[model samples]
Target: MKLNTIAALMALAGICSVGVAAELAEDPEAIRLRIGTGDPVAGKAKSESELCQGCHGEEGVSNVVGVPNLAAQFAPYLIKQLSDFRTQSRRHRIMNAMAEGLSETDLPDIAAYFASRSRPKEDGAGGPDANAKDLFLYGDVERNLDACASCHESDARGRVSRGVAYPALAGQQSGYLRVQLLNWKAGIRNNSPQGVMNRVASQLTEAEISELANYLSGL
Candidate 1:
């Protein structure tokens, strides 16, 4: 990216109030998650009329235990998931029905509205146990497990990999995260980049899943 473009991205990051650093411009695989995103103002009105707020709170905080929070999540990721739901690729009945009625623009619009909010508050879990911390910060070499930060970042804010914006995991619902991890481990959910999630989750015991979820949700 040109210096001017990088500066402009920084300025837009401020306007969006997202936690993106201009250095991401230099990463071949990293693209700002909000680049060319939809208008949040329009999205708010759309989400309300479409009843999207019934489950995901008006502020994008999830009210249900298994549902994921969307506040300050990556817009690109939101768009991709919604697109998948529409195509039935991700396979959720309610999501598919809801997404089916949406026009093409509605996808990005809704994503923008949710992404416009700041991250949700901590889940009150405080911090991860030592085992979870170890797994996240430093993978077990004996197990050939890669550190969670290799993709999700140490802060769990996520990072762009191969132009894919890994969803932010910090402040995500523990139940939701656990279920996804379990699904990956069991090969029930198989959309992760390069099958990495499946490989990584397969290495985790159930206790480790709970431990990681508890720690990440607290962030």
Candidate 2:
């Protein structure tokens, strides 16, 4: 499906008042039982068997417009996303379908496989506005904007936090990050159950959003 179409569908899904009851019941143990925190070698075999290469690229460096580059993504993040996809906690028709068949054992192998591969150099092509840089470094507390450095770090190198999912943003394409931000604003990507990102994105103006994307891309 076209990326725009997928985005629109996700938006609709988010706004549809349908309670995601099915997704909430996802079996965490199923994934745990399968993955078992095993070695990356086993993860590689699972990735191959699951045809992850088809969309995620041969080594998880996806070239597709909407699909993210998984190469160099933290293993825990990958595992969480996989588990969410499988359980319907994260709702994406295509991803849900893809993840549905995976056993718990499959996730570790996939996570390890992508983690073991080298992260490709990002082709970031953008410049940041001075105001955007200021916002990133020192948030406008009066406006209730939090500093990006608090979670993503001053360098934007992701750091893990307990009970929170912090994804690496450094070296990621700016356009991709912008798209994701827009998705969060539009409620298309509901990764945060507590709606932190939704609230944050809602407060940002179009220009600020553009500037932030540009700034992160150049980082």
> Each candidate: what lDDT?
0.77, 0.64
**Best by the TM-score measure:** 1
Q: How do the residues 1-219 of candidate 1 rate in per-residue lDDT, one tens digit apiece?
A: 243453354355453343333333444233335433576667778989999998998878888878889886887889888888888878787999999999998988788777756677564663748888889889889999999987788888776567787888889888888899999899988777778999999999998999898888988
Candidate 2: segments with Cα more than 4 A from true spot: 1-38
- Candidate 1 matches the true fold with a TM-score of 0.83
Error of 1 at 199 (Å): 1.3
Question: What lDDT does model 1 reach?
Answer: 0.77
Best candidate (score: lDDT): 1
lDDT of 2 by residue, 1-219 (tens): 232332233234341112212211343332232223544555666777788888778767677766777754666777788888988877888989989998877776677556544544467555657897788788788999888777677866554567454666665666677887887888887876477778777777877887887787666
Can you tell me which runs of candidate 1 are displaced by over 4 Å?
1-32
Candidate 2 backbone collisions, by pair: 34-104, 34-105, 43-109
TM-score of each: 0.83, 0.74
